[model samples]
Target: MLERNALTFNPGRDQDAQPVGSFTDVRELQQELQGHGIQFLAEADEGTTGPASFIVVDPDGNPVIVDQHV
Candidate 1:
């Protein structure tokens, strides 16, 4: 069996999966991380809006997923 874990962020949702009134867009977060020299394995399209996602690798080799479902 193949096994792995990832850290995920849902920008528009809370811990209970309820929508919040406002939250930072995923693209903006990506840009900020990029400015800090973070690289992405898969990237969200900055040109689009609404739900999107991106992936990056942690120093420990774990996948980090930043997904937005708004």
Candidate 2:
């Protein structure tokens, strides 16, 4: 069961990758996000994930995958 969020963010990784997300400006967004103390755990294309995104750790140590298709 899949539902769309108001923010247009995908709840699941594959579901999120299914739709062409509205984010076209990713570089600045990535930089701005990093400036806020969020460090990238792993880059999307760096390993198994083929998308161009980065991972950030939540306060509880959960890996939040921020994916961008290049």
Return the top candidate by lDDT: 1
lDDT, candidate 2, 1-70, per-residue tens? 5432222223223463665535443445556776797777664333343346566666666666555554
Top-TM-score candidate index: 1
After aligning candidate 1 to the native by TM-score, how far in Å is the CA of 50 from where it should be?
0.5
* TM-scores of all candidate predictions against the true structure: 0.91, 0.49
Clashes of each: 0, 0
Question: What is candidate 2's CA lDDT for residue 30?
Answer: 58
List residue ranges in candidate 2 displaced over 4 A: 1-21, 43-51
Report how far residue 14 has shifted in candidate 1, in Å. Answer: 0.2
Question: What range of 10 consecutive residues in model 1 has the weakest lDDT sum?
Answer: 1-10
Q: Candidate 2's error at 2, in angstroms?
A: 27
In the order shown, the candidates' Cα RMSDs to the true structure are 1.9, 8.2
